[model samples]
Structures are given as C-alpha cells and as structure tokens.
Target: MRREITGFSNPTVKLLKSLRDKKHRKREGLFLAEGLRLLTDARACGRLPQMLVMATARDPHPLLDALEADVLASGGEVIVTSADILSKITGKDNPQGVAGVFAEFDTSLDRLDRSSAKIWLVAQALRDPGNLGTMLRTGDAVGAGGLILIDDCADPFSVEAVRASMGAVFTQGLAQAGWDDFLTWLRAGEGQLVAASLREAVPYRGAPYAAPCFVMVGNESRGLPEDYELACDLRVTMPMKGRADSLNAAVAAAVLAYEVLASLEG
Candidate 1:
C-alpha cells in the first residue's frame, strides 16, 4: 500500500531520521540509500529496500513511476512525502527525490567463495569513507573476490561511503577482521600475499601476483606495520617521480589491482 507521510512524528519518518546515525543504522541492521541512480543500482544488484521514500514533486516523473512499480512488485512499501521531509531524511536542503532503507547484506568472511576468488583485497585501518568506497568500486571492476576490512576502518554502509562507491557497495562482498585474526586467516589461505611498501620492495611490475592472490594495503597515513609487511610473500612499490611521497590509497590500489588482473589475462 502507498502511504503519504505529512508529519515528522510518523513512525517511518522517525526511523529514517534515526538511520542517519551509524549507531542507529547498526542497531536496525539497515542502511539508507539516496538518489535515483543509487536506488536503480540497488535494484540491479537484486536488492529491494523494505521501504522507499519519495519526494512528491520530482521533475522527471517516469523514473519515480518505475521505481514505485519495482518496489511495490517486490512487496516493499512506498511512501510519498513533501520535499521538506526528504531534505530532513537526507540532511540536504536540496535532496534527491528518492531514498530507500535496505537491510545490510551478509559480508562475513566465511561467505566468500574461496575456490573462485582469484584476488582478494585487505584494507587495514582505512579511515576515509570515500577511499574505501572507491576501492570497493575498483575491486569490483578488477573482478576481485571480496574485500576484508581489518582493524578500525570506515563503514562501507555509511552514506558517504555508499555515495562514493556509486553503487558498487551492492555488488562487492565485504568482510571484517582484526589484525591478528586476519594474520591467522592469511597464513592458512592458499594465495600469495602481495603488499605495497616503499622500503625493501620491488617495482610493482616485477612482483609475481600468483593466482588466488591476496593484495594487502595499509592505512592512509601509516603504511603497513613492519610485522604485517614481513608476513607478505612479496612487496611492491609504484614509481614516484613527483614530489608527492605517496599516491592516494584508492588510486594506488586500483593501479595494482588492474596490473594484477592484466597479468592474469596476459
């Protein structure tokens, strides 16, 4: 059934407002997706939000029609509200015309397909949401099996991260582990551990990225811990002729990931 929410006190509106916070989102086991493109991408990835909220005065009406149809067909509720309500939900004065509340996908480590996982990414203590989001997109582009977040990393489901991913969040499998637990898993896994480092590392092109490789990257400010770097089977570095000490973490990961993929194709 289509419902029209006219007041802020409505239960659904309150719930949507609470979801803007990370703690509330975690407690509810749901995340909010905003914008038409993101919702379309969510549907493409086989996710139907439990509830969809739309601003009543969207200029391009056909997109809203399609979105409403898809949501209703999947047994989801569609709520139409004023522009003010949409702005309140998304914290933007000029908000997108649509938003959705989706249950979090299972990103547990054990859920990954070990056999077919040609390359896996491990991001350690990633603090930046935008970087992590781009990494998710890059990982998907390079056909990585999944991404594992070790230690204190940004929430992939956060609004900033999700927006930065450009919908890649729905397509990429994700996992979380601590440094020690990740080390244990890495030791038991059957792939070459390739890490990026400046000290005692070979050129990126020279490193052998064996099949079922696991690429490890460190935090934005701090590179991998020496012990972690030592654990890797190989370490590689990108060429830096400019004055910059290091490249953006996402760019560096993409370059290495594509290189690894290209090697396999060759």
Candidate 2:
C-alpha cells in the first residue's frame, strides 16, 4: 500500500527535512536526492532509494510514475504528499515534486591505490556546492580516479551539490581529508601536483599530462593557499584572453580535466 503524507508536519516529511544537515545524514547514513534526473541516475547506478516521495497531484509527471514503479519493484517505500510539504521539506521555493532518501555510498580515500590511479582532482576550500557538484560531474566525465576535498570545503552530498551534479555524486569516489593528510597522500603517490594559478609561467596545456598525476584547484574567491603552493610540482595557468581574469572554479576544473584526458589519449 502507498503511504500518503498530507502535511509538512508529517513525521516522514520532518525526517526528510532533517537530511539537510550533515550530522543527520552522517548519523543516518543516508542522503536526500531531489529532482527526476538525480533520482533516475541513482536508480540507474543501482543505488536504489530507501524512500520515494511524490507530490499528490492529478496527472503527475510521467517520470515520477516511472520512478514510483521502479522504486516499488525494487522493494522500496513510496510516499505521496502535498506540494507544500515537499517545499517545506526541501526548503526550495520550487520543488520538483519528487525527492528520495538514499543510502550514502562509501567515499574512502584509503581505498585508492596510487599505482593504478590516473588523474585526481583536489579541491581546497571550494565553498560553493554548485561548483563542487559541477566539478564532480566533470570529473566523472573525464574518468578521474577520484576527488579529494580538503578542509572547510562544501559538503558534496548536500542537496544543492547533488542536484547540480545530476547524480554524478553517487557514482564518483569522493573523500574528505585535512591539509596535512592531503599533502601526505600527494607525497606518497609522488604524482605531479599541478596547481592552477593565475601567476604561473607554465600554461595548463603545456603541463605534463602523464598518468598518476594530481591537479589541485583552489577556492572560488581566493586562489591556491600560500603553503600549498610550495607543495606543487608545477603551477599551471589557464590562458585568459577575455576581460575576465579567471574562470569559474568548475569551468576551470573541467578545462584542465579534459586537457589531461586529451593528453593521455594522444
């Protein structure tokens, strides 16, 4: 039988809303996914959702119907609720009428072995969830080995980040480490640490795109950290011909990741 939750005050609705916090997600070992695309991707990846919530409306979205069937077939619970309830749960002015709670996938950096790894993207203090999500999607596209977020970075599992990633978050290997831990890993791997810097003499295209390398991109407003620069084997810059002195953090990461891929392909 399908469960119908009518109000924002519903117990299920409150639980979904609590997933917005990292602590709750950590304690429960679950995260919320919003929108059809993200939920679809999660299903496609075999990360079946624990619960599916849909807005109670006539002529519901076709995709939602498909998702409901899929979730039910997979032995998951489904709930129908009001649009107001969904908005309050997601804290979004415009709710997509569908959301899901899924088990958080493993994201351990220790599982990555430097011997077989090719390219890795390290984000230091990337505070924008959207940018982090885009980076993760692009990283998946470029077949990056994994992503490492240094201290004080945005939570990649956040709803906004997961939405922006379009479900890439579920597929990618992500790990959070402190600055010292990151440095230790980079040193142990002995991989090229290519820092993206505006003042660098070497252009991004000129940097060696050899296997088993790591590229570090810094925060949105601030560039690379001063101490981190000393750890970089090479500092590479993206050529800027336009009026803008720099590109967005996600755009910069994609440009560099693809370049590395192209170089490896050659």
Candidate 3:
C-alpha cells in the first residue's frame, strides 16, 4: 500500500521514531535504516524493508524509483512525508530523505556454518555502534562468512551502526551470543579461536592461521579480559610503534582480518 503521511502526530510516525530506542526495537522486533544508498544496498542483498519511507521532497533517482517498485512488489508499504517530518522521525537535523523499517532477522549463533568461510570476526562487549558496524564491513571485505558478536555489544541494528556499515549489515551474516555460549558453539565445530593479545602470543603476520579462523577482538577501552584472551586457541599480537598503545577495536579487527585473509589465500 502507498500512503502519504504529512502530520508529525501520526501513529506510524511515532512507531518509526521509537525504533531509535533499543527497548522499542526489541519489543517490536524491528529496526530502522535510512538513506537511499543503504536501502538500495539492502535491496540488492535480497533484504527489502517491510516499510520504505521517503520524503515528498526527495530528489528523483532511478535507484529510488526501482527500490520503491521492488518494495511494493514484495508486499511492503511505501510512505511519503515531508523532509521536516523525516528529520523529526530520524532525530537528525539533516535526514537522509529516506528511511526504512526492517524486521530483525535471526541472529542466533547456531545458524552460523563454521566451514562456510575461511575467516570470521568476533567482538566482545563492544560499546560503540560505529565500531560494530565497521567490523561488519571488515567481515564483508575479508570474505568472512559473518560476524559473531559476543556478550554485551552495541545493537548492530542501530541507525549509527547501520549507517556506518554502509550496507554490510545486509550483506554479511550476523550472530549474537554470550561468551560461554559462543565458546561452546565454536568448540563444537572445527574452528580456531584466535585472540589479539600479548600473553603467550606470536606476531600477527605469518601466525599459524587456519581455515575458519575466528579473529576475535575485545572491548574498546579495556581490550580482552585476560581469561578470554587465554581461552583462545591462538594469541597473536600486532606491533605498536607510536605512542598509542593499541589500535581501535574495529581497526584492530580489520588489520588482523586482512592478515588472516592474506595468509589463508596466499
């Protein structure tokens, strides 16, 4: 169905805006993504948002038109409102002119197939949404099957993270689990859990990197907890030449991911 919403007080507006809050998103089992590019990337990845919303003043684009048609053909709703109202819903002064409501798909760790890819990225207690999104992108770039988010990481479905992912969210598989649960699942199958740590560690390059190697990173501020680092089958450390003690959590994951990819492919 195609609907035009002009009033900010509309109930649908309220519902879409509420998705910005984690509690509301969880309760509704839905999350929001904005921007024509992100939504278009999602469409290309076989993920059509349940609801596609756009501003009446949005500039015309072939991609946007194609997206709208695809959404409607797939039984999705299309909403058009003023850019002002779009900004209000997105909590951004400059809205992307388009936003979407997507049903949160399955993210259970059990659904992950370990042998599907040579490398996987894991994050523990990641607090920053941008970092989480960047890791997802890194996983996509490295040809990792997906990203397994461990413990209390930021909501990957959040707007900031989703935006930062630049559409990797739709392209890459995502899973969430606690450390114990993740460990059990990883140990059940043929996989190597490698952590970036100094304890009993070898240099990251030319490390005994193996197929389905799970390159795990830790909390941004604290890094990996000692026991968690120790639990890994392999510990690899990167050199820090500058005054900075370590790379950002996401950067570390990307750096380590590329190294693992090169080692496995070469």
Candidate 4:
C-alpha cells in the first residue's frame, strides 16, 4: 500500500529536496536516484532505496510493480505524489514517474577487496561531473574492479554525474581519498601503478601493464603532478598528431583502462 502525499509540507518531500545539495547529501548520507531506469539498475544491484516517490498523475508503469512490492515487503515507504511534487523533488519539469532517495554506500581503499580485483581506476582532482560519470560508465564497460576518486573531484552522487553515468553509478565500486592517502595506499598494494602522463617518454601501448593494475588519470587541466607521475611504477603517454596537447580526461582514462584490460587478457 502506498501513502499519498498531497501537500508540500511532507517530511519525505523536504528530505528529498534537500538532497539536491552536496552538503545536505553528505550530512544525511543519502542521495536521489531519479527515473525508472536508474531504479531498475539499483534493484539489480540490490541497492534499492528505502523510500520511493512516484508521480500519481501518470499511468502506472508495469515495470514498477515488482520494485514497489519489494519495497513494501521490506517495510519501506512508497509515496504516491503529484507531478508538481515530483518535479519539485527532482528539480525538473514533468520529471519521471519514479524517483527514490537512497542511502549512499561507503567505499574506501582499505575496504576494497584486492583478492578478486584485476584492475582499478584512480582519477586525481577530476572536477567535471560528466567526465567522471562517463569514465565510471567506461570503467564498468571494461569490467574495472573499482574506481578511486582523489581530492577535490566532482561529487559523483550529484544529479548531473548520476544522470550522466546512466546506471553505471550503481554497478561500480567507488571510493574517495586525498592525494597523499591514495599514494600511500597505491604503494602499499602489490598492483602496478600505471600513471597516464603527458611527460612520459613511453607510449601508452608500451607501458608495463600487469595483473592487479591501477590506472591513474589526472585532472581536466593540470594533470597528475610531476612528483606523483614520477612515483608511479610505470608512466605512459598517449600520442596525438594534432595540435591538441592532450585528450579529454575521461577519454584518456577509457583508452588506458581498455589497454589494461587487453593486457590482462593477452
């Protein structure tokens, strides 16, 4: 049975609206997952939100039956709300019929299971949400074990990032750590740290990509700091004949990640 929320004063609605901000999300340990597709992905990953808010103005989506039933079975709340209310929560006009407020998953380098992980991706100071999200999607496509986000990166849980991820956000293992901490963690591990750099003499194809690989990608502008690049086990460069000095951060990451995947298979 679904609870009908007809007014703006509902506590659930307020909480969902507040989650649009990063600080609020971090404080509450919650984030919003909009659309049926993302909810479907969450359900597939066994990470479905405890609270669901559906637009009552639209016809029922047959796809939502199983999810709604599960939520109700778990003693979770399903809100039957107006289009205006859904739009207010999602900050979009005539938003999708389904939206959910899910608790964020905790991830850390220390918590990562290295035993089964073949390769991981580290993005240092990557500020673009679209790039980060796209990279995550790419990482998922190539079967990366996980992703490490360095200091001051875009909030991966942000609406733009989550939307851009197209459901990869739910499937991928993600963690955040500062530069020093990440470096320490990288060095402590047995995996080969392959840093993507513009200064490296070795071409990307020639890099020593071994099992348990960790591919490090830099920021949109500055890239990996020189000392950081020098600290890596292997440094590789992608060659470009055109005037462009470097590739997009996400594109560079994808290229390197795929190569690492190929190396393991080879």
Candidate 5:
C-alpha cells in the first residue's frame, strides 16, 4: 500500500527527517539513503527498504517503477510527498526525488566471510563519512569482499556516507568492531593484516600480498598507533616525493588496495 505525506508538521515527516541524525537512526534501527540509483543498487543487492519516500512529480522510470513495485510486493509502504519535504528529510537544498529507509545490517565481525575475497579494507578511527564511503567505493572497485571498520569509525549507514559510496555501501559487506576484537577475529582465521607504515616498512608495490589480505589505514589526523602497526603481518609505505607528506586515509586505502589487487591477481 502507498501513502501520501503532504504536511511538514506530520509526525512521519518529522521521523523521516530525524534520520539525518545518528541518534534517531540508532533509536529507529533504520537509516536513510537518498537517490534512485542507490535504491536500485540496494534492490539489486537483494535488499528492499521498509519505507520509500518519493517526490510527487518524479519523472517516470522503469527502474523506479520496478523498485516501487518490489517494495509493495514485499509488504512495504511508499509515501509520495513534495520535493520540498524530500529536501527537508535529506537536509539537501536540491534533494534527490527519492529516498529509502533500510534497516541496518549485522555488523559483527563474525558476520564477515573473510575468505570470500582476496583483499579487505580496514580503517581505525576514521571520522569522515565521506572518507568511509570512499573506502567502501574503493573496496568495491578492488573487488574486496567487504570493509572492516576498527574502532570509532564513522557510521557506515549515514546518509552522507551512503551518498558518497555511490551504492558501494549496498554492494560491500561492512563490519564494525573494536581493535582487539578484530585482531582476535583475524587471528582465528587465515587472514593477513597489512598496513601502511614508515617503521622499517617495505614499499607498497609488489609486496607479498596474499588472499584475504587486510589493507589497513589509520585515523585521518593521528595515523595508526604503534601497537596497531606492530600487530600487522606486514607494514608497507607509499612514497611521498612531493610537498605532501601523506595521502588521505581513503586515497591511501584505494592505492594500497589496487596494488594488493595487482599483486594477488598477477
């Protein structure tokens, strides 16, 4: 069944808009993702949003039609509202015509199947939603099975990160865990923990990267702690010849991911 939400004062509107904040999302156990492409990607990934919000004048499309149909067929609800309301919900001046509310996934370390792919991306204290999303995008690009966030990372389901991921959030498996828990989990499996480092590290290129190699990056500002680096099976460094001393956390992951990809694929 479908519904229409026309008033800004509507409690549904308020709840939908509240999803823009982490607290509301945590309370509701739902996160919002805007844009038709992201919704379509979610659908393709065998996920259907529990609630779909669409603008009243949205242009017709087969994909959107398919999405709406699937949502209804699966006993989900659709709300048709004005573009301005969509803007309010998304906190965007020019909101995408559609948004979806999906339940957060199981993000425990045990839910991750490490042996499924050759490379995995891990971030420690990554604070930026955009960077987190970019890491997910990089994971998708490198054909990694998933992204494992270790300690105090950005919320993977935040709208900004979801938007930045460009649908990689839906495609990539995501797990969040404390550093010690993650290390314990990794040790229990046949996985290699690798990170970018400067303390007696090898060049990132052509390293002895193996299947299930975890390419780890540290906090955007603080870098990795000494103990964290020491725990890694390998520590490789990227060259910084120019004035820039280091790469962005997400960029570093992408570069290291690609190198690891080449090494394992070769």
Candidate 6:
C-alpha cells in the first residue's frame, strides 16, 4: 500500500525537509535526489533509496513507473503526497514531482585499486556546485578512479550539483578530504599530482600522464593557492593560441581527464 502524506507539518515530511540542510543531512547520513533520472541512476549504481516520494497527481511519469516498481521490489517505501507538501519538503518552487532519500555511500580512496592507473580530479576550494558536478560527470565519463574534493568545496549532493551532474553524481565515487588527508593519500599511492595553471610553460599534452596521477583544479575565481604550486609534481597548462585567458574549471578538468584517458589507451 502506498502511504499518503497530506501536510508539510507531518513529522515525516518535516524530517524530509530537514535533509535540505547540510548539517541535518550529515547527521542523518542521507541525501535527497530529485527527478526521475537521478533516482534511476542511483538504483543502477546499487544505491537503494530508503524512501521514495512523489506528487500524487504526477503518478504516471513513464520513467518513474519503473523506478517505483523497482523501489517496491527492493523493500523500499513509496509515499504519495500533494505538490504543496513536496514543494515544502524540497524547498523548490517546482518540485521535480519525484524525490528520494538515499543512504550516503562512504567513499574512501583506500577502496580504489591502486594497481590500475588511478586518476582523480581534486577540486580545491571550488564553491560552485555546478562546476563540481560538471567535474564529477566528466570524471566518470573518462573512467577516473574517483573525485577528491579538498577543503571548502561545495556539497556534491546538493540539488544544484545533482542537476548539474545530470545523474552522474550517484554513479561516481567521491571522497571529501582536507589538504592533509589528500596529501596522505598521494604519498600512500605514490601518485603524481598535476596542478592546472594558466602560467605554466609545459603543456598538459607533454606531461607523464601514463603514471598513476591526480589532477588538481582550483577555485573558479582565484586560481590555486601558493602552497599548491610547490605541492604539485607537475604544473601543466592548456595550449590556447586564441585570446581566452583560460578555460572554465570544469572544461579544464575534462580536457585533462581525456588527455589522461588517451595516454592510457595508446
């Protein structure tokens, strides 16, 4: 039987709304995934959402039917609620008509296979969720080992991030670590760190990318910190004969990721 929730004031609905806050999400060890595609991707990635919520009026969204059936088979609960309640729960003007709460996967760099040509895209102080999500999607596309988010990076599970990733967030492994933690991992793997910079004389194409490595992209506005200049094993720049100063952080990451992939395949 599908449970019906009428009011946003209901305790269950209230708890769902709390998930919008980072602290609450952390405390509960879960995050919200909105829309049909994200929910589908989550399941495909072996992430079973604990609860599925859908607006009662929007029942037959074709993509959602399979998801609902799959959730039911997986011993998950499906709730039907009004649009008003969904909006309040999601804090979105137009709720995607579907949303779900999924258990957060504990992703650690230690889980990765070090014997492979492990590649990670580390975002340092990247404040924009969209940029972070784009990087995640690109990372997954290029078969990156995982993403390592450094200090002060945006929450990869946020609504903006999920939307920007277009469902790649759930498919990719992610590790959020501070500078020291990343440094520790780098040392453990003996992986080379290549920092992207506009001032570099060495083009990324010429770098020794065949080895196990992690590429670092800095903040959207300010580039990498002064200390990162010394930390990186190699500093690389993209060739641009045109007038553009630099590529966007996400674009730069995609270029570097594909370059690494090409090197591995060749």
- Kindly list the per-residue Cα lDDT of model 2 for residues 86-176, writing each as its tens digit: 8888889989878888888766668766665577888999999999998888878888877889889988888889988888887777888
lDDT of 5: 0.93
Q: State candidate 5's TM-score.
A: 0.99
Q: In candidate 6, how many Å is residue 88 off?
A: 3.1
| TM-score, model 2 to reference | 0.87
lDDT on C-alpha atoms for all candidate structures: 0.85, 0.82, 0.92, 0.85, 0.93, 0.82
What TM-score, computed on C-alpha atoms, does each candidate reach?
0.92, 0.87, 0.97, 0.93, 0.99, 0.89
In model 5, how large is the Cα lDDT of residue 252? 93
In Å, residue 108's CA in model 1 sits off its true spot by: 1.5
lDDT by residue (tens digit), candidate 1, 1-266: 68999998888898998887889989999998898888887788788888999988877666667878988998989999999998898887778889998998786666777567688788989899899989888888898887888898989888888878888888777888898877777667677888888779999995777878888888999967888898888889898999987888888888899889988777
In candidate 5, what residue range of length 10 has the lowest lDDT sum?
Answer: 203-212
Which candidate's TM-score is highest? Answer: 5
- lDDT digits (tens) for residues 1-266 of candidate 3: 89999898999999999999999999999999999888988988899999999999889999999999999999999999999999988889999899999999799998888888999999999999999999988888899999899999999999888988988999888999999999989888899999889798999989999988999999989999999998999999999999987899999999999999999999
Better structure of 1 and 2 per TM-score:
1
Model 3 alpha-carbon miss at residue 134, Å = 0.8
Report the C-alpha lDDT of model 4 over 1-266, residue by residue, as the tens digit. 57999999898789899999999999999888889988999899888778988988767666788889888888888999989999999998859888887888886778776556778888989999899889888878988877889888999998778877888889888989998998788677678888777665588885678878888888898988898788888888887899987889889889998888887887
Local error of candidate 5 at residue 73 (angstroms): 0.9
- Judging by lDDT against the true structure, name the best candidate: 5
Q: Which candidate do you rate higher for TM-score, 3 or 6?
A: 3
Off by over 4 Å in 6: 59-63, 115-118, 198-200, 240-244
Candidate 6: lDDT of 43?
76
Candidate 6, clashing residue pairs?
Answer: none
Sort every candidate by TM-score, greatest first.
Answer: 5, 3, 4, 1, 6, 2
**Which residue pairs overlap in candidate 4's backbone?**
none
